[model samples]
Target: MTIPSVKTILYATSLSNHTRGVFQHAIDLANVYQAKLIMLHVLKPLSDSNIMAIQSYLSEKDIQKIQNVANQETKNTMKQRLADFYQDEMAGKNLPEIEQIVVKGLSRYAIVEQANKLNADIIVMGSHNKFGRSSATTRKVIKHSGRAVFVVPTDG
Candidate 1:
């Protein structure tokens, strides 16, 4: 059988400090294959208090304005951080096109959904390998993504 070449790689991250160790694998693979890297960070929905505050004190336009600014700032920070990580890990060599994404939702569902939406050739992520084999999110994505999943063992 002929093996397929990877075109796009989705690196689903938890944005945890420990996961930094495992993130290197994604950068290495992307460099080796020269594939586009989609860096994704999924955040759980904001606290009830925050949501209530938005509804109570903020108009629709005001909410949008505030949230949009927050979102853009978050995007910029994530992108810069990931870029720095890649650069530091690889010594600024063989960098790939990296797209940073942030969204609020259930991690398992959001990750698989994004992978499918991006038509990613592979999904790479870091897991603590807690529950027998991997974390809950890792297992769910492996089962539901319908794409190749690479789970890097992080220093939990």
Candidate 2:
């Protein structure tokens, strides 16, 4: 019998403050196994209500400008957070391949799709406490991806 080893890890983040623990888990596993780490953040598309509200108050050009600005800000925020995570948790250490990915879509589908694209061996993510142990995104990923997932408790 042959044991399977990890080669790629997908670290899915909601970009919430609670994700530090989850990211740490991913980093540790990747370093231990010398696996590539793929950091992913999925942003949900604007809801119809939100779009209608914006359209009610702003012109089409104005809405486009606002979206552009928002997109840039989100990218900047992700970069800064990635740098902070690396510095705070893994400063001056040799690690495996690391990539940052940010996309606008449903979190569950996005995470599963990205993980499949990277052929990830495992996924690490943050979860709520026992009370809300399973989030919709987490559940969906588990159900559809058919991949191993390690969910760290963010409430702790």
Candidate 3:
């Protein structure tokens, strides 16, 4: 079998254990095809109503403090996770340009938008095998993505 020349690969992850498998796949493909690897994590935005409801339960100062703490923790966690993944799995390998991106938005939409912006040749994503029905997000990505998507089964 011939491997396609993957110039750029986008790996969308939710920081799940399953996503680690997706990352591994992306790394292997990147090494094989000499493709740039882009790691993307999307954070869902809290709605105004949701924020208001949470704020109502606490003093303004307390709410601000909590929000600041949460934001800082999230940033730290993401940075550490990305660094660990790279060091443990991707380091010492002749790989293409590797970039990590963290964006706040809906996961699937954010991934599709980034893929388009980057002109990615392939997207590697992990999927759970309980296939009763596809999620709205999954359907949307399948419909809208111009690039090919390689779904790695989480359970497999």
Candidate 4:
């Protein structure tokens, strides 16, 4: 029997308060296995109606600017969270090599796509209990992702 090796870890986050615990778990695994950690946040696309409404009020240039601003905001939030997480959870510890990215798409599809693109050996994420069951995204990722997944139980 051969054991699987984890060289790269994909940590998908919704950036909720409870995600800190899940992030810690991913960091722990990365540290133990000396794996590079990739932090991913998926931004859901705007609904067609919402897009039409915005288009009605804004020019193409203005819409592009709005999108640019939104993307920048998401990037800033991801950076701030990483800074805080490192300060609180990894103070003085040798932090693992971490790469952060934010992409727009459905959560499950984006996560699975990223795992494949990054060639991640494992996917780590939090599963919120909703009516005594895991979130749909969590369930779908596990079902669709061919890589190993480490799901931490989190509050809804």
Candidate 5:
């Protein structure tokens, strides 16, 4: 089948230093295709067991306090860093509409679901190239995405 003209691209990131290269690649692809860029950050949800375990080690009040602090810190960090990156990318270029999405769920599944929902032409993400577990997770995402995925090597 002929490759369709990409009109929208999803750039999935974890706001990690290593993922910077992947964001750059996404910007380049968006520029080339003149496509809208969507930046996605998935925050893995805290399981009930995990919450209960934390509560067991600390008072309920203390646990709530810690959880709130952690969540706020994460949100602030992601927001500031992503804002700076996006601003820099669009400084003097005719950038397409860029949307930032932050959601709580499984990264692989959430990312794939968002891509499908947004009708993204392509999904670009950074890979740590970890074997075994990580590879398996990536494979699952690729299999279920039903869209083009470009995995950029973080080490390279």
Candidate 6:
């Protein structure tokens, strides 16, 4: 039997208060396994109806500009979050190499898609332990992902 090796880890975050704890777990696993870590944040795309409503009041060029700005802002926020994580958690310590990205889609699907795209060995994500149960989204991501999922429990 061949034992599975974790060479790449996909860490999906909602960027909430619980994110830091989850991220720490991801980093720890990467450190132990000497794996490359990829941090992903999913943004749900605008619904068709919402896009139509906005389009009614704005030109196509204006809409494109808005989308560009929104995407840039989200990328900026993701970078800052990573910076804060390193400063607050790692300090002067050199962590395993990490790549951060933001993509648009439904949360659960997007995470799985990114994991597949990156060919990640395992997915590390946080599950809100509310009422002694994991969050539905966490369950869905596990259900949908073909790779191993390491869920870190967090207080929401």
Deviating ranges (above 4 Å) for candidate 5: 1-3, 52-76, 86-91, 129-136
What overall lDDT, based on C-alpha atoms, would model 2 receive against the true structure?
0.82
Runs with alpha carbons beyond 4 Å of true place in candidate 6: 1-3, 129-133
Residue-level lDDT tens digits of model 5 in 10-114 = 998777776778888888899889899998877787899998888789998997797677767776876787678768765776656777777778888998999
lDDT per residue (tens digit) for residues 21-119 in model 1: 656788788888889999898777778898898889888899889777877877887777776785677674777888888877889999999998899
Stretches > 4 Å off in candidate 2? 56-62, 129-133
Predicted model with the maximum lDDT: 4
Lowest lDDT sum, 10 consecutive residues, model 5, at 129-138
Q: Is candidate 1 or candidate 6 better by lDDT?
A: 6
Better of 3 and 6 by lDDT: 6
What tens digits encode model 2's per-residue C-alpha lDDT throughout 1-156? 876799999999877776788878888899888899888877789999999999999999999897778777877887788789778877888656778887778888999999888899999977762244557678778889989998887772
> Residue by residue across 79-124, what tens digits does model 6's lDDT show?
8887888888899886999988888899888988889899999999
Backbone clash tally for model 4?
0
Selected candidate, larger TM-score, 1 vs 5: 1
Off by over 4 Å in 4: 129-133
**Global CA lDDT of candidate 6, please?**
0.86
Candidate 3 accuracy as lDDT: 0.76
Q: For residues 1-156, could you state the per-residue lDDT of candidate 4 as single tens digits? A: 886788999999988777788989999999999999999999899999999999999999999998889888988998899899888879998789989888999999999999999999999988883344578998999999987999998876
Judged by TM-score, which candidate is best?
4
Comparing 1 with 3 on lDDT, the higher-scoring candidate is 1
TM-score of 5: 0.74
